[model samples]
Target chain A: MSVTSTTSQPNYHILSVLVQNRSGVLARVAGLFARRGYNIFSLAVAPTEDDALSRITIVVDVESTPLEQIVKQLFKLIEVVKISELDPRRSVERELLLATVRATCDDRGQVVELANIFEGKILAVGADAITVSLDGHPDKLDDFEELLRGYGIVELQRTGRVALPKLDREARLRAVKGKVV
Target chain B: MKMTGAQALIKALEMEGTEVMFGLPGGCILPAYDPLLDSSIRHILVRHEQGAGHMAEGYAHVTGRPGVAMVTSGPAATNMVTPLCDAYMDSIPMVCITGQVPTSAIGTDAFQECDTVGITRSVTKHNELVMSAQDLPLAIRQAFHIATTGRPGPTLIDIPKDVLQNSMEWHWPTDAEVIDSLPGYRPTMKGHPRMIKEAARLILESERPILYVGGGVLKARAAEALLELAELTNIHVVTTLMARGAFPDSHPLCLGMPGMHGTASAITAMQQSDLLVALGARFDDRITGKVSSFAQQAKIIHVDIDPAEQGKVRRPDVPIVGDCRLVIEEIVKAIRELLATGSTQADTSVWKSRISGWREQFPLSYEPSEPGEALKPQFCLEALRDSAPPDTILVSGVGQHQMWSSQYWRFDKPYTWVNSGGLGTMGFSVPAAIGAKVGRPEATVWAIDGDGCFQMTAQELVTASTERIPVKVAILNNSYLGMVRQWQEMFYEERYSEVYLSPDTPDFVKWAEAMGCVGIRVDSPEEVQPAIDRANSIDDRPVVVDFRVAASEKVFPMVPAGFGNDDLLLPPSQMARKEFLR
Candidate 1:
C-alpha cells in the first residue's frame, strides 16, 4: 500500500546508515527497502575505519513514503547501528561511471580526445573498443554518459552516489577563531 | 570460562530471565536441545513449530517480556513463518532461535538446511545468522533488547550447528556492554510538553470527545492512566478490539468495542464525536472502516510510541510520539492543571446524555434460544464469563466466536483479554492460553475457540495437559466457519460453499478426551452454564467444553468491510428501520 502521500512531488533523500560489518547485513537492509516498495535510486556500501562497522549510503525517492517513516523502518533492523539523513545541499556527492564504446581504428584517437574533454581516463583498450572511466558529481557523470551514448556504447556501469556531510563553514570559522594558542 | 555456543546461549537466556520456552527439536537444533536439558529454563515441546511460536507470543502477551521459541532449520523454520508474521503484525515481543546447518554446509544444500535469516527477515523486526560462536552471546542479548524495546516485535537468531558446537570464552556481559553495542535504538518515552498541553486544550474544548484506546495501551501498561484521564475528564472511552480489557467494560463512560463487530453505541459515538483522544492506537482499517469517512468530524489527538504510526493510516491534528503510559500521564497532568487554572471545565453533559440515549436505544443484543434449542454462541460466552473468575484471561481463536466473545464478555482489567488482532490467526487460542497460564500460573485462563479453529491446533491441548497447565478451552461448536458463513449469508446470496464443516468428523469433545483434557459437550441452553461450571471446577487437568451453538448466528452492528462507519448494519430485527442508520 502507498503510505503518506499520493499527489506530492517526489523529493530525493540520502540516508547514511552505519551497520555491523557482518554477512547478510547488507541484504537485510536492501530487503527492507524492497519489501516496503521504496525504490532505491542509488546505493553504496563500504567498511568504515572501524573494521567492525560498515557504512551504507542510499538515495531513494520519498514520494510514497515520508522521510520519518523510512528512517524509522531502517532503525527497526537490529544490524543497523545508526542512520543520518544527509542534506543534499550540505553534502559532497560523487558517482563513478565506466563505459566501453565501439571505437574503430579511425575513431580511436577521436574517442581519446572526447574522453580528455570530459576529464575521463582510459581504463582499458580493446581491439575495437576503449573503456573510459569518469568520476564526478552525479549530474556531471550523467552528462558524460549522454555524450558517450552517441558512440554506440557497448557497455556501461555506474556506481550509485556516495556522499559525506560537509563541515559547517560558520562553525568551523568560529572553532578556528576560538582555538587555543 | 569456556563453553560451547549452545551452552552459552542457555546461559544468556537465563541472564535475560527467560523462565520458559516453547519449541520442537530437530537434527540441526539437536545440540541446542541437549544444552536445554541441563538449563534451568523449562522447554515445552510443541507438536508444530507454529504452535511453539504462538505459545511464546501468548506468554509474552501476558508477561510483557519477550517470549522465546526454538526450532530447527528448513521445514521447521518455514513452519514458524505464520506465527512470526502474526506476532509481527500485532507487535508482540518474541525471540525465535532456529538451528541451521553447519557453516561450511550453509550453501551446499545440506540436510535440513534453509536460509532461515532470509526467509524471516521480512516477517521479523530484525534477524541474524551467527557467523561465529563468539557472536552468539551478543546476538542473543541484542535479540532480547530489540524484541522488547521500541514497538515490540519478533526477532530471530539463526545459529548454524557448528557454531553451537564450537567453544567460546563466555562471560555474562554487564548492562553497559549490551546497551553500548546498540547505538541506534533509542525510543522517545516522554511526549513533548507543548503537544501534551495542546492535546489537553483540544480535549477541554471538545463538545463531544471520545478516548480511542488500542492494544498499545495494554502493551505499555498505561490502562490505569487511561482510566484516570477518562474518569477525570468524564469523556466516553471506546476500546478497540485489541484494547478490549484496557478499559473496564462496566464503566459508565466505556463505550465497549468500536469496529467491525463493535457495539452500536460505540460505533455511533465515534462517528458523531467532535474530537478523539487516541491513546496508543493506530487507526487500522479494521477499526476505522473506510478511512475517509471514519471520525470525519473528529479532530484527532493521536499518541503512540512509534513515530511511523503517526500518520500511517490517518493523519492526526496533534501527533505525540512517546511511551503510552508516560504520554497518558502527561495528558492527565496537563488536563488537571488546565482545570485548576479555570481554563476549562468538563461540560460535556449534553453530549454525554446523547451517548447514553444511543446506548439505551441500541444495546448489543442476541436472541435467546428457546428451551431445548441449539445454544447461541453469545449465550455460551456470557455464561462462561459468569462462571469464570473475574481475573481470568480470555484467549480467543479467530472468526465469529471471537467477535461474539469480544462483544459479550465484560472485561474489567487490562491484560485479561488476549486475541490475534492484526493477523487474526485462526488457531491462536489453545497454545496462547497455555502460554498465558504458564506466564501467570495463579490466574485462570480460558481459550474460547471455534470448531474450525479448534481443529487447527487442538493438539496443543496435549501439551497443556502433559505440562499440567490446566487452562480451560471452550469450543463454540457451530459446525461451520461461522464468520465466513455469516458473510456469505448476508452478502453472497446465501451461497454457503465450503464454510460448512461436517458434524460427524472428529467431534471436539472426543478429541479433547483423546488429549487427556476433561471433555464436556453441551447441546441445550440449560447445559451451557453447567458445562462452564464443570470446566471451571476442574483444576488438575485442562478442560474442554464443546457448546453446540447456533450454526447460523451472525455478528451484528457490522460496518460491512469497506463501508463507512456511518453505514453500520444493526441486527436483523433493526435492519428494516431507516431511523437507526443515522
Candidate 2:
C-alpha cells in the first residue's frame, strides 16, 4: 500500500503498474523504460481481475534513478493507470521455476525429497535427469534451485517475480504513489 | 456515407477545424493527397519535411491550436523527427500524420517503409499505427485529443497505405466518445484546494519571493493570472526564454530572462530569493547551471500540468499538478481570501531596490560599430523591432540570434514570441515564420535568423514566396557560425575549428532573389533601419534582409558550462571585478 523506507538498501524495487489492456501496451511500457534509460531488472505482465486492465510487475534497479522519478515518468505513459510500489516488507512475491536436473536412479529419491520439501513437483522422469517445477516466493525458489544444482542441473528458468501488497489494514499504511520524494 | 480511409482522414481533419496544413506528397501519402484536392483546407507544400514540421510549430505558436504536418513513410517521416521532437520539448500542440507502409509490408522493410510509431514513441506524447480503415477517423480524433490536451505535446498517427486505400462507412464520434476512448488520459484542470491555499500562504509569508515563469503559462494562456499573482504579491517576475511574452516585458515587475545568457539581475534575484513560485517552468539544466548549487535559499512552489515535472529536478515544497492558468487563478482567489482575514501583502520595496540596482549595474549591451565596420547584430535587431509593428510575431532560429532576439525585443503580448526553446533547433525560423504568417495573416512575422541557421533551411523561403505568405527574414549574416565561434574564442582558446563559414559564398541577397523574395543587403549602421523599413513595406512577396554584422560579438552575462549561476561571467572587460557575484 505504501513505500516505507527500510534501513537496508534494496538492490531492486518492485512496482505493480496497472495499465489499460490494449494491444502493444507491453511494447509501449517496455519502450518507455528503454527510452528513459531506466534499468529494468525483470518484468512480468498479465491480465488482472478486470479484463480491461493488466498489471505489469516491474523489478527496477534504482541505483542511478530516483524511485520517485521512475514512478512519475510511468504516470506520463498514456496507458499507465496506477503505479504502486511493492515494498519488500509489505508485499508477497512469487516466481515459477522449471529445471531439468542431472540425477541417477539412486539419487532420484533425494532429488524428489528436496523438491517435495521445497513444495515442488516432478513433471517428467528421465533415465539420468528429472524435470521439476516449483512455485513459491523468489527466495524459496532460489534455495530449491540451489539444492537441485548440487544434483548437477542441466537447465533452469525463472518466471521473474510477480507481487501484490499484503492485505493487512491494521498495520502501517504509507502511500507513496504520486508522492514527490 | 461510405468513404475511403483517405477521405475519412481528410474529413476528420476538416472536422477538427483544420484551416491549413504543411506537407509533401510521396509514395504512401499520395493517396491522402488525392482526397485533399476535394477538401477546403489549404495545404502548403513545403520543400522539405523538416520545414513542414517547423511551419506547423510556428502556426501553432500563433494560433494556439494543434498544427498539422503530414509526410510520407521512411525518409520523409524521419525528416520530420526534428520538428516533432522540437514541438514535443516545447510542448507545442501538434498532430503529425505520417503515411506509413502498408500494414502487410510493415516490419518487413517494404520500399519507403519505416517503423514510425516505434521510432517516435519516446518523442511524441502518443502515437498510434492505424491498422484498419474503420479505425482511421477515431485514430485521427485521438491524435488531436491527446495532442491538444494536458501538458500539450506533439502526437502522431501513422496510417498504413492500404488502410487509406480501403473504404468504410464514415463514423464521426461525438466529443464525449473521444473523451471516453482515452480513459487513462485526463488532465487535472484545478489544483488541490489545500495546496492552492498553502501556495497563497507562502506568498503572504515570504518577504523575498519571485514568480519564476516558463512556457507552461503561455501554453495555459494564463498570462493574465500570472500577472495578477505578481502584482498582488508584489513579486518580481523572471520569465524564462520560453515564456518571453507570457508577462509583458515592459511591466515594472518584469525581470527579463534568467539562466545561461540571462540577465545578471534575474540570475542574482533567483539565487537571492526566499520563495520561488515556479509556474510551468521545469528547472532545466540551462536555468540551473549547477543543480546542487541552485537556489539554495529558496523554497519552491512548482506548478505544472505534468506531475512528473514537479520534482524532476528540485524537490518542491508545494507541488501542484494542474493547468497553470487554473492553479494560478486558484492561488489568486486564495490570496484574496487570506487577505480578507487581516493578512497583508508582503512588502518587497527593498527587494525591488536591489533588482533595480543590479539591472543598472549590468544592462544588456554591445559595442557599437562605426560607419566603416559591419553593423552590430543587436543594433540591426533593434532597428527591426522599432521598424516593425508592436504586434509583429517575432520568431528566431537557435544560436546567438535566438538569444539576441530574446534579449533585444520588447514583447508586451502573449504568443508574440516563438522560437525553438527546449530543443534549441537551428534553421527553425524561416518555415516557422511562414507558418506563423499563415496562422495570423494580418500580423507581420519576422524570422530573425543567424547566418549559420539561415543556410540550413532558407529554402523554405521559396514556399513563402510561391504561397505569398509575406513573412520577413532578417539574417544576421556574420560570415561565421557566430555562437560556435564565440564559444571557441572564449572556451577553446580561439582555435575556431570549422566555425568560419565564409561570408560571401552564397550571397544571401542574391539567394533570396533567386527564391522570388525581395532581397536587400545592409552592412552599415544607418542602413539597418532602412533595410528593415523596406522589408516591412513589401507585402506582395517574402522579404529576406541580409544584415552583415560584426563577427566578434558574444551573448554575455553567461553562466559558463560548469559554473553555478552565482559565478556569472559578464563581458570580458568586467570579468576581473566579479562585482556581480553575489
Candidate 3:
C-alpha cells in the first residue's frame, strides 16, 4: 500500500490479488482499472493451488491514482477476494528473460561465459545467434540484459515480475536451525 | 421439484416477496413472461424499459425492498442502462433480470443479442450471467442480497434464453449458503466500540457541530436513529438534496438542503461549523463545491457503509464504515453513557442563533406575482406543497422545478420525497411517481416535473392509466428548459441556445386526455391550488396539470458551479453574476 517506501521511477505497487475463478473475471478486473484510468504496468494471471480461485499479480503505476483507490476499486469487483500489496523491501520479485543474441563461432565463448556468470541456460545455438533464458530478480535481469546488448541483441522477452513475501527473520532462522516450536 | 429456469425465476421472485414487478416484454424474454401468467406476482407492463427501471427504483425507495424489473437483450437491455445508472447513483436497491441470447448462440452475435452482464457491469453492484438452469435460484438470491445489503445499489441477473427454457431441480439457497458462496462480500454493519466512543465524544464536545445527512440515511432507514442522534446532541441538521426528507423540515434544528442549490442558512452553517458529522453521505462535488474551501473549519466525522467513500473526497478525521442506523444508534448509546458519567454537552447556542439569523436574512424567496405576469414556478410548487396532505409523497424530475420543489416543499418524513438526486434524471418523476404510488397505495403521490422533464417520459401515463395507479403529475411549464436557461442567462451571457421547447407543440392537456387521464392547464398563480386540489380529488386515473410559469425566474442563492458555498448569489444579487463569477 505504501508506494513511497521504495524510491523508484513512476512510484508503483505490486498487488497480489486472489480472485474467484469464474468466467470473465479477468476482464472485469482489467476493465475496472481501464475504466478508472489507472495504468497497469504488467499483469500476470495464473491458477492458484485452490482450483476455485486464481492469483493475479499486477504491477500498477500509482502515479495518478491513489493506492487506496486501486485497492478499494478492485475490492468492489465481486470476483476479487483479497488484495495485498507486496512491499519491495519485504518481498522477492523476479522475471524470466528469454533472448536471442547475435554470437558467431568467434565470440560464442564470451557469450556462453557471460550467460554462465548469470546462471542462464543456453537454449539453442545457430551459425550466427545464440538463445538464452535467464530467471532472476528484475534488477539482476536488467544488468544481465545490459551486458548482452554488446553482443548485438536480436530478440528478447521478460515475463513480467512476480513476487511473494519473503519469510521473516525469525521464521528463516527457525527453518535453518530446524528448531521446534 | 423439477421446473423450467423461467418458472424458477418466478418462484424465486415470489420467495423474495416481490408482489409486483415492472417490465416490457420482448423476444428473448418471452419465455419468462409466460411463467408470469401462472405466477402470483403481478407484472406492470411499462411503455418503455426505462420506465420499468425507474418504477422499480421508486417502488424500492418507499417500500425498503429490492424493486424488480425484467427486460430482454439488445435494444431492450440497452434501454435499461439509464435506469441502472440512475439507481446505481442513488443507491436504490433494484434487481433487473435481462434475457440474454442462448449460451450456444452468445458469442455468435445472434439476433437481438448483447452482453447484458458485460454492458451493465459498472452500473450494477454485482451482475451475473446464468449459463445453467441450476444457478437461477442462487443467482436471484445473491442478486437480492447484494442489492439490498451494505450500501444498497442496483444488481442484475442476465439469463440466457436457453437457460430459461432448460429444466433444473429447484432448491432455494438459505442466507448462510448465499453468504458462504460470496466469500469476499461482507459489509461492516456496526461501528467499532472505540470509534463509536470517539465519535460520541466529538459530538458532545464540539461547539459548532452539524449533521450533514445524505440519501444513505434513507437507504438505511436510519431516519429515526438519525433524528434521535440529532436531538440528543441538539445539533442542527442539513439534509443534502439526496436527503431532502430524511430529517423533518419542520424541526427547528433542521436547515433545508445543503449544496449548490441549497438554502443560504444550510450553506453558511456548514461553512462555519467546527464539527461535521456526515452520516451516510459522500462529500459529493455538488455538496462540496470547491471542496478544499468547503467547511474548512470543520473536522469531519463520516459514517457510511461503503469503505471506498471514506476518503474519496474530503478525508474524514474519524471514518467509521458501517450501516448509518447501527452506527448512529451506537453513537447515541455511547453519548448517553458518557453523559450519565457527568459529561456536559457543548454550548452550540451561539452557533444556533447565527444560523437562525442567516435563515431569516436570506430565506428562500422569489419575485412576487405581478398582476398580469406569468405564474412563478415557486408559487406553483408552494401551492402544491401547501395543499397536499402532510404525508403525501412528492417526486420531482431534475431541473429548475426540482430545485424549486426541494427549496419550497416542507418534507417532514422519510421516503415521502423521492427524486433522482445523484443522476438528476429528468423524466424520473412520471414513472417513479407511479411506482411510489404502487408501493404505498393509500398515500397520494405527486410528480413535480419540469416542462422538459415531463416531455421525456410522459408516455408512461398510458401505462399508469392501464394499471389504474392513481398518481398526480404537475408540470411546471416554462416553455424553455428553465434550469438551462437560467445557467445561460447567468453564466453564458444569455445566449438562449437550443433550450426553448415550443410550449404548444404537443399540448399536455390533449396528451393526457389521449392517455385516458384528466388534464388540467393552469396559466395564472391563482389557478395553481384549484388545479392541484382537483387533481388530488380524482382517484380513478392519473392526472397531469400543466402550470405555464415564467421562464425568467432562476433558482438562487446560487453557488454557480465550481465556486465555494460561501459565495452564494442570493437573488436580486444574482443579477450581479459578473462580480461573483469574477
Residue B228 of model 2, lDDT score = 91
Pick out the ten consecutive residues of candidate 1 chain B with the lowest summed lDDT. Answer: B573-582
**Best-fitting candidate, scored by DockQ:** 3
Report how far off residue B448 is in candidate 2 (Å): 0.7
Q: Ignoring the other chain, what TM-score does chain B have in each prediction?
A: 0.98, 0.98, 0.98
Candidate 3 Cα misplacement greater than 4 A, ranges: A1-10, A102-111, A126-130, A149-155, A173-181, B573-582
* Model 2 spans > 4 angstroms off: A1-11, A169-181, B573-577
Write the residue-wise lDDT of candidate 1 on B1-582 in tens digits.
999999998999998999999999999888899888888999999888899999999999988888999999999999999899999989899999999999999999998888888998899988888988899999999899889887889999999999999999997767689888776667788999999999999999999999999988988999899889988988999999889989999999899999888998898888889998888789988889999999898898999888888888888899999999999999999998998998876578888788988887788888888877788888888888888786999999999989988999999988888899999999999999999999999999999999999999989999988889899999888899889999999899999989989775777778889899989989888777777788888899999988888898889989899999888889877667627534
Ranking by TM-score: 3, 2, 1
Model 1 stretches with alpha carbons more than 4 Å out? A1-10, A166-168, A171-181, B371-373, B576-582
lDDT of each: 0.88, 0.90, 0.90
What are the TM-scores, per candidate, against the unseen true structure?
A: 0.95, 0.95, 0.96
* Candidate 2 lDDT tens digits, B386-479: 8888699999999999999999999999999999999999999999999999999999999999988999999999999999899999999888
* Collision pairs in model 3: none
